[model samples]
Target chain A: MNGGLRHILLALLLLTGLNPAHAAEPIKIGSFLSVTGPASFLGDPELKTLQMVVDEVNARGGVLGRPVQLIHYDTGGNASDALRYVKRLIRRDRVDLIVGGTTTGDTLAVIPEVEREGVPLISLAGAIEIIEPVKKWVFKVAHTDRMAAAKIYEDLNRRGLTRVALITGDGGFDKSGREQLRQLAPEYGIQIVADESYGNRDTDITTQLTKIRASDAQALINFGFGQAPAIVTRNVAQLGIDLPLYQSHGVASQTFIDLAGPAAEGVRLPAAALVVAEQLPDDDPQKPVLLSYKNRYEAQHGPVSTFGGHAYDGIMIALAAVERAGGTDKAKVRDEIEKTQSFVGTSGIFNMTPEDHMGLSLDAFKMVEVREGVWTLVENAD
Target chain B: MLEQLFQFLVTGITVGSLYALVGLGFALIYNASDVVNFAQGEFVMLGAMTAISLVAVGFPLPLAAVAAILITIGVGLALERFAIEPSLGASVVTTIIITIGAAIFLRGVALLIWGKDFHALPAFSGDAPIHLGGATLLPQSLWVMGATVLLVVLVRAFLNKTLLGKALLACSVNRAAAQLVGINVRVMLRLAYGLSAGLGAIAGILIAPITFSSYEAGIMLGLKGFCAAIIGGMGNPMGAVAGGLLLGVLEALGAGLISSGYKDAITFLFVLMVLFFEPTGLFGHKSADRV
Candidate 1:
């Protein structure tokens, strides 16, 4: 060979030799959460769990022997901010996968962007719309409002509570829950006698409660989160209503019990098994994963909530997909995520399919009631 | 039907008392400084948050409440001194804008101090509901009404009977004339802020048990209170009480009878009607522009 040809061949060999080992890029995961705004209660814990899991995965050599990079932006519970950050993550960060959204409103805001970008997104929001008419690139880990409503109605049915009163807040979650209850109550053989709604900032719901009390309702089902539910609890007590109160999974945090105080006692809600992890039977499939997550999380943070478990499941599912796909190729990863089945996660045993983005079923929730400010498993209710 | 009416009435009165209390705060600040201190609602939030924190730290409820009111008074004085006093000779719009800025600043400060969690104070008495015919009323409702009435009486007496109160009114009527008469207009303004803040704090503490208090609670309460102030003639204290109660009752009735979803809409609609028809308000004097 000529001298020039020999030198070019040598340089090409050197470049090819270095490329195999060093060319694997880190998998970028972006998240837009309401870490500082009204929905911080949900976002803060979720971000913590994501960070902890990412650190643990990286410590274990990450997926496919490549490091995972997490890019998190605080959406501040605002839909516009969520859309802005989602665009930024896709355009600027070039993230391979995304996981976030504390509220349904924010999650819905970013759906079009995530779909158009073809980046696989696992939303942490509980709205069913995040998954319904399932988009190719979108999935959710949080139990949907429909699932929660079904669980609540099932419990009500078991108790033979045929007549129910619904008091929902005027937020997105509450509105969706109200719609689900209205649509699904007939299926569960329950009649909603009085459906009332109060403003999210309303101080007193006595008038609503009074109307409910006078109705033919045998029980009160309050579908809301935040201080409004607590205020409703207080109002129910103040109105001397003697009916049973069923809350949605929205108020699954200890903060709800704290805000409601003595009034929170005997209030039952459908929550993920992570809430009563220690009380789970030894044979329960989710117990070990739930307990481990609970311990790891509480060792650093104060308490572990199911909201955080949603993030854990989202991250774990994404990691598992990357591992199964053997690379961070966006299409391959998205297909693997869709094929996820029987993956034990902090939220539940995820079984993602092409038709079902949220792999969780109604069985993922256990009926839990507050006893002396602590979540206790309702006996034989699940 | 009677029972429903009674329940709505009870709710209206309770909420009206709170609106009145907040409206009075607005009026007090408007009278002295000719600037509507939009931060009036923050005083309420501070009162409830401070009181809750104190109570959490094991102070008696009464003592915590007193300390909360005192701290809010200090905050009001500081706001007047730092924010209002510096812009004394500014245009009325400028002063009003400054007050709005002050409100935003106070809310941000509160968010940092208390975080974003909602807090509740135990009712001053207990949680028992008093059975009145077919309607049940919380004991705290009575406490709220009683406190509002007592404050109204005390303020009426103060404004009518005391020299300091007269100086405040004199400042409100004519700042230059009051200054000419040797009244310290600055002191009167400071006192107005202090009293207004204290009044707002009292409203916060009284309503916190019922409403629950969060860092952002001030915005809605302040807006509604401002509406009450406008409804009752902006500069009239007694008019504020009447306007507040009227607005509250109307809101409760609307919610109880009409769709609850349209509760706020109905309330604001009434305010719009009032503003369109009676530009000055129900109790406002029919006079030309003072300036």
Candidate 2:
């Protein structure tokens, strides 16, 4: 009877042991993006890029020979929605890592949960505050608002335009850009002559444009994204203000020009090279990567924007760390991500260190002007 | 300072005219049926989007504008027949809720048809700013003001001079008496909806060149128009025009003289002050309670 009991215990152990060897577990990568709602323009393309890259990576025998499984949720451009999904992804889905947060508000909302859960999160938002205090487990991929303001200021300095008028929306991204532009103006030898703001629901801004027209500002700087920027362009033309208009990197897509019509001509903005990939010089390091991304994206989905490029950099960087760590262990993956250096991406060359989690500088931007409704590289403007 | 004042005045009148047109739409429907049609603003959206789509498909601008107005009338009539007619004898709150649902349904349909992008129509004339004493005016502003004046005159003539118009007004004053007097009060309600929708379409086409139109543009415009109707006193057409202009001018002047951040706040504050001083509204009549 004792021999029979020992054999039964051995059989149970064998059954459990054989289950592990039958199939290799897949590495799970979860994300929450603003796939619909007001910010869908940013998130829709991002979702497409993530799907494409994940498919390509898995086809090549994903990180450490384990297939990649992507779990995605749509945030619908709301902060509370992002938080709820992040919790589910951490607890229920049991994902190895997370890559998401298309907008700044969504990204900032998920940071606390991400830190407490001990999951490595690579964000795609443009807010500097996300990385400034540097939580141990959080990192970002998009060019920050500070970098955008610095890039615009550099171009303004080059053009010798000192007096600037600032117009911004009340959204978080616009607020951050406005703050950075105000703080960094004096250091760049720029003087703000007029500062104006408008609400998101406003139908007309002729009053604000009239004030800007009355100012001694030599250049008008608009720091808002979406349909509002188009209204500003139209208002500028309607008010007959002939000062040079400089937009922040927020209006970096063709939709802005399409809405503004002929009024978009001569408007300049600092944007990522992906906007004018075909116009880049041969020796530029980002040329090949931008072309490949642009071609692949446009082939699958009609056109590509810089917003999608942020997601590309995010997923690629996260996967690179996974490969470098040689496994899906969370602690080892976090360390490998911190040690990432000289990684070329569509946005810019990412050289991450413990001190600088963003790993991108002002050099990521290229000054481009809208010429006849298309982006034209402003030669030698840098 | 004078230049700033002139600039503010031009912008105020331009925007005020748009509000007036939308308010007129509210006033007409309120006069015929005791029910307030909350879907009035969606009429404007449909008008503008339909015209834009028609123009894109190679119709002449004038032809497209006319087509848009006709199509909007049909939609308004259909809304009355399907959504409003079935709820006859319902309470006021129920009718209002039904109209709100209609507005949401229209907005959703527009989203599926047009997608989520702001569309623009080229100005009827050149886009040159007319310089006047250091303040410039967009030609579209002139178009808006002119259209409002024309609409107000036509509506006034229709209400005061024509027998059919008088019959519609009779229905508003006493529906049971109008029906007893052979005025066909139900027909008057349908006519009122048709006219209000036509007015809304004209307003949409006129303002689309300036403000641009998207699927979500109607809600704020609808709310503001409702506020104007209240400020001018409900069921009064000319009062709606005055209320709309006052609201627009107040908003523009507040933005220019005080703070743009408080533009919306100032407008609502004025509305509240009016409600406190004159609960019936600036031009509202003092009617006895029915009960």
Cα lDDT tens digits, model 1, B158-239, are 8879998878877877899999999998899889999999999999999898888988889888988999999998877888
Lowest summed lDDT across 10 adjacent residues in model 2 chain A is found at A15-24
> How high is the DockQ of candidate 2?
0.64
lDDT by residue for model 2 (B1-291), tens: 888888998888878888988888998888777677899999999999999999999999999999999999999999988988888767889999999999999999998888777788888997887888877778888898888888888887888799998888787677788899999876888899899999888889988988788887788778888888889988778888889999999988999999988888999999999889988779876655311
lDDT of 1 by residue, A1-382 (tens): 3566445534544654645455346789999999877788789899999999999988987766568999999988999999999999999999999998888889999999988889999999988888889899999998888888998888888888899999999888899899999999889998989999899887778877877877999999999888999989988887878889999999887878888878888999999888889999999988999989999999998778888999999999999888777666689899999999998887778888889998888788889999988999997663
Worst 10 residues of 1 chain A by lDDT: A4-13
lDDT against the true structure, each candidate: 0.87, 0.87
Each candidate's B-chain TM-score, in sequence, is 0.96, 0.96
